[model samples]
Target chain A: MTLLPGRIATVFGGRRWRSLAPLAVLIVLCILIAIANPNFIELRNLVRLANSAAVPLTLAMGLTFIILMGSIDLSVEGTLSVSAMVVVLLAANDSNGNDYGWWAVLAAIASGTIMGLISGLVQTTLRIPSFMATLGMWFIGLGLSVYMLGGSAIRLNDASIRDLALHRFLGLPLAVWVAIGAFLLAAVIQYYTRLGRHILAIGGDEDVTKLSGVNVTRVRITAFALAGFFFGISGVLAAAQLGQSHAVIGDGRLFAAVTAVVVGGTALTGGEGGVVNTLIGVLIVTVLANGMILLGISPYVQQTVQGLMIIAAVALSLDRVRLRIVK
Target chain B: MNETFSIRRIFEGKWTQGAIPLILLVGLLLIIEIAAPGFMTGETLALLFANTAVLFILATGVTFAILLGGIDLSIQAVASLASVMLAQLLPSLGFAAFPVAILSGLVFGILSGIVHVKLRVPSFVATLATGGVVTGLALWVSNGRAITIEEGGREKTAWINATIAGLPMVVLISAVIGIASFLALRYTRFGRQAIAVGAGEPAAWAAGINVDRTKIIAFAASGMLAAIAGVVLAARLSSGSPVLANQLLLPAIAAVIVGGTAITGGLGGVARTAVGALIISIVRIGMTFVGVNIFLENMVFGAVLIAAVAITIDRSKIAVIK
Candidate 1:
């Protein structure tokens, strides 16, 4: 007999209907979690959950486009760390004699953009695999971050910026607001932009996209650059929330972001998911973590669960017909 | 077109790939000796070998997977797990702990292989996920703390630090493994199958090669070797932690690529990886002598890695770089 998941897959086999699977999973998770702990559905806990999901939401938004292009970016942590360090050092911080304020935020995003652009160049111009180029870029970003920090954590003295994390608007923090804004912007781009279409096309079939007269190189680079831009925003948000930044502020984020993107129904092989799916994915991951804590499960087991979730999700969503050999 | 053809020929030339690294190794040693007068002494050489032993072993293990045109990102995590296993088991199992620890790595490697082969997940992603699980297991088993080998267990590991004919026992062990790997890759049916599969999977399959078995075995060997490196590391450090081999991943990968083995696969060997590992060690030591800041070293490695992959990657083999 077909398993429950298989039966669901058969029923919702339409291309458009596939996106509903993650949504269904998210809803079921919330229900199950609410049953486990009656307090889980409370407004305060959810607001906190939304607040926690801000950075990951931002991270996964950018990653969605990249993975949609069938290219992986392992440089999220590096990009995030570099941008975070940039914002901290350039803003009104204890480590440096600078108070560029909002300009610091602009500069942080620009730094992330430039790093992303470099990764794109390395991937397209140099013809290195996206993963390897980004992996190296991750190190470069980390080293750049460490070099900028000069071996110390820099506290953000700018209350205006730190307030982004602390202050609430409509019961949701400004960080979550910023994340929501990013999400909306990403959704618009995914649906309305020509670049978005190109990304999906490339992920679907690069050769076909190229043969159809699309500038595959430019599209790929732009996708990476756009992802980098998001990473920059998330970096600033992360630092603002923490009130301090270090070289490792981006550590642990890459895995979480990747896991969320994959679990959100965006196949690593690309072309099947988008930012909307990632939003659901971000909530699922955030809610799952919160539920685990509420159920008194050991924190360490969370990582194992995330890893297994990635394997299972990828396996379920995998397009086995298109691949004869996997390497 | 003619110039491009010639360039490709030179790069694809097996001897050129191996020769470049050897030249770089010699040139680097010469530069270091000139800069720091006594850096080339036999004592320093032995120290260099000793220092490079673990990295070499780790790199060599990963070479098997790379040779198959896949990668094992879990090596470092597996290595860390193995170290933790060895340290914890040594207290009770003594010498038997080494094998048990190694066996754990083998099992994990097989799991990675199964995930990649059976599930059709990409090697890197499969290994990444497995690495995460292994890291969690390592943390859980060690209780997220360092485990120091007690006096009784210390004696079991002491021989790792011992010298045999002026070479550290660790270095000797790595060399033997390296040589064995070279032989296995050169003379054995498994080695030839690995090469065939890596060269072209469809072609190998058409030629009746068991491509799946080769890939799995390659990953398994990679895992086992990584575990062996972990055991040696625990012996030398007298302790184990979940993060013991954390920093070695990039260096090990760098060693494999820099030794002139093409990341695209089927062009390099275990011997080339040995040269590559030594090259990495020398470059790191050379950076120390040049007084490059420790933090900036990673940046240099990143730059060097990009340059190496750019030079060594076989563009002709891959129609689409992604």
Candidate 2:
């Protein structure tokens, strides 16, 4: 009996070989794809992968907070899109000659943060489920973005703002550096802060957290606000990279970010997983996407494979004993 | 005497919950009728019924998944795949392909269920993952092209589109499915088990319910019904495009939630959801008829959904918002 218990402890301690399964698969895929095309190992490809991973990584880090609280935020895509559009509309050297400079970026971030706050308030004060509340934000954001942009893609020509994506730092783009910094900040807050512990407690057991005087509502609202900040940053980065911004930029980020969070060994049921896991998750997803493109796989097939991989990752990481019903 | 009085009160409370969506539906219709006199015309009404048919069907199917406190986000992707398959195989397999297409959807949905239950993943993630796979499959099968039925197939398409006794065939089908689902939820053991599981998983488990299996079955049923909806939609449109059903996701979920179903699981039924779908369809159609700016309309719709959920969700039961 002691031996069985010991084995279980070892497995749960994150020291066992099984904990590395997702990492192993990721490494193997990278190796196999690199072998298939030696160019995949080139510095340019690696840099490209890092750059591409930047936005999703930031978004995933934001989602990690909400997921850790055993809730979800589906509004990231809409918020990101709206922010991106705002960045382009305000700063882009368009035919209208509107050049608000760096202020545009500030405005974009503020919009995203405000949207997040509203969603958090609705969920916490109004007692709406996070899923429904965030979804409502999604529609509102999408509609508002479209209304603001008027179905036109705006080109960003502001050199200072665009430098974030185009400039290289430590042999990788500045965007990647920003993503790394964001990741570190998130990790710190998640592990070291009182709010972080409270979030985990909430996810683990809401009543228990409330009983412990955790101020559950405030913590959740803060998490969402932080999530919105990350989304705003991601939107700016996205616009910088593409040199243009449109309302549709947010279309696919939600799935990609959620996928990364899941791949990073974060439990969808929440109260577990962290920024480090999300970093790995982001790398895995970005690598998979990059590998598929490098291997010349059709975009359609890439989507299918990505979908399959998401399912497989969740299946491998999910803890069945804890959940009574999954919805 | 007290027992009888309490029973009557219980019945009345249930009716009140059921009445909200009905009232909203009538209210919207009345507003639309006043705003646009032509909105209630036979042709306009027929078109609205036809347009809502697919939504109603999909909503009904999703109601089952929602009933078990799980959501099937894969319905849109499944519908997309089913639509593509039906259209692509029509010439070779003719009408026989419809069942095959729907069956594929059911299989995919069951796969999602198995993964959710057996792997112990949350239904949200499980369905989300499967939804991605289904979307990928749809894209792959369609080769990124819309598959249109052959030119001469109009006769069959029209036949399928034709109304029975002045009711659109799609609406009639939706009605039949809704009635069947209503009965299953109200009368069957499976339905009771689902409600029990949703109400409190631990309690249901203690009561000897196979909670996982019930939830899985509910998802499977949802998938099958979504496929049926997809087939109907494909027949109506006479084409299958991989991207066509993508927009359906929000509306279907919105309809389910607005219908008084709890997002946190338990305490909703098919009848309530059907009423919810009707309300949604009318609101959307009515808004269009009134010529509300498309963008503002979306915002309003989303706001309404959130407001409805805020009003309808039972706060006492859910101790924490998350």
Candidate 3:
């Protein structure tokens, strides 16, 4: 657990070498890809990589809090779809005459927050596991969006909405900047806030956290709440970027977000790792997918590869002695 | 003394295992009768039994995994893969296609089990990963399209759509599977071992049980049943579809959990899960009968599912929920 023998970087708990492992692996992956295809290092491709990572990065950052608390949220796709549909329907769109402008953005975020609150309440008050609560909420969200949309896609045409995701600033896509800003916000929350520290403590030892005069339930609710807000924001951005919205808008993003969290050296057992690690995880996933696409790899094969990587990452990051049985 | 007494009570209370779902199912039926009086006819009951068959088969296998305190998210994916394989193999193998598809499912389940055991990875993640791979294989095999059984070949699979003595042949098949599984789980050494491992893994291992073998075998059983369900599903549709097979996964898992089998493991069986599946199908049908919004139905199902898990969960056995 020493600071790597005075190397200046505080490699916290260097005993397991986990803190540096994902980063090292990510670097190796980048180098290998760069060698295999030098075009991978090109600025245009790299920017596109960052742009793609933006939505997922926000999702991972939000989810990092929940995972830190040792709970899971499988409702991301459901909430994402609901929020996406909400924003599209509220904004100046083809499906409806209503045009709430920026207020629609607030509405979208509110929808996600509400879903998170329901998930949190179900877990804490009902004493149901987070997995099932969130899963149920996922179906609820999916059903809500599907029902509301009535099986139709709505195209958003708001200028402000387009600017939120599509506009470029400082030679970078707006989506990328939004993602970086989200990461910074999450970092501040993780390191400086009482709620964030409490989530980590609860994950580490729930009984100890409860005994120390901490409101475990409230902290958990807050974690899910913030995560929901971010999921909503990501959904809005994703829909805006695409200019079309439907119930399936966030179809496959949950796995990618979860993979980023676990691959970033965060123990699925909880209470280990931070946003910086997640950023590295997100980068690794983004780069790998981008590289595979550049190499003309088939989508089906890429799915298999990602699935394998998920297995490897989870197996490697899990602390065996601490976690004897995994359900 | 109190802890030991409670544990013994949980083990012996067969009535408690399915009591809640039974009450819920009865109440739901009554409500359905009152709301839509004509809907309780023999035809409606037949349709209910028919639709319940697929999920009942899926949940039967999931009950094994739940008894072992693990889960198999790969069930639906394995079923999907089996469907595609059955579709492709039928032209060549005809009647043998069913066994071949079932074997593929068993192999897929065993593969996931081996990974989970050897790597000590969580079954949740391991099954999910394997499910992803299976999904890919399905799309690849079917070339991402539905494969319809054509012409006279359809007649070979017609039993799937046939009715016997007023009930669909599918319902009869599920009943047979259910009866066999119920007997095996209640009377066999493997079944007892599954309960022990789920009730307390550390204690089971200490008491000289082959915990790993029991878990892996249970998972494999789950896969086999799910594959059978897929075969029947494909037959009923007269076509095999990768996507359609996946749609049944969540409902099946919900049925198993809602059936009063603890997610923490042990204390329920296939019979209980059968009740759970029946409850789900009834609720779905009853909602439609009452003119309930299908969207609201999803929300209500989610809420009810949460309540079901909350009521059935063995909190004392589990220290945390992830």
Write one digit per residue (lDDT tens) for candidate 2, span B107-170.
9889988877776666776787788788878888999899997775545567668878887888
Alpha-carbon lDDT of model 2: 0.81
Model 1 is docked with a DockQ of 0.67
lDDT of 2 at B169: 82
Q: Among these predicted structures, which one has the highest DockQ?
A: 1
Task: Give per-residue CA lDDT, model 3, range B1-322, as digits (tens).
Answer: 5675785476436576568677877888888888778767999888988999989999898889878888888898888888888888888888899899999899888878876876677787788777877877787778778998776658778888899888899999999999999988889998888899999999988999988888889889988998999898888877887776666767888898777888878878887888899898988876776688776666777766677677777778877555
Q: Can you write out model 3's per-residue Cα lDDT over A28-80, one digit (the tens) per residue?
A: 99999999999999988888888889999988998899988878888888888
What is the DockQ ranking, best to worst? Answer: 1, 2, 3
Going through the candidates in order, their DockQ values are 0.67, 0.57, 0.48
TM-score of each: 0.96, 0.91, 0.92
Worst 10 residues of 2 chain A by lDDT: A1-10
* Candidate 2 colliding pairs: A327-B70, A327-B124
lDDT of each: 0.89, 0.81, 0.83
Judging by lDDT against the true structure, name the best candidate: 1
Off by over 4 Å in 3: A1-16, B1-17, B37-42
Give the Cα RMSD of candidate 2. Answer: 4.2
True contacts kept of each: 0.66, 0.77, 0.62
Candidate 1 lDDT tens digits, A1-327 = 134443555577745666677888899999998998999989989998999999999999999999999899989998999999989988999976999999999999999999999999999998999988987898889888998788678899988899899999999999999999999999989999999999999998999999999999999999999999999999999999999998779866887898899988998888888898899888888999999999998776766788788888777777765887787
Better of 1 and 2 by TM-score: 1
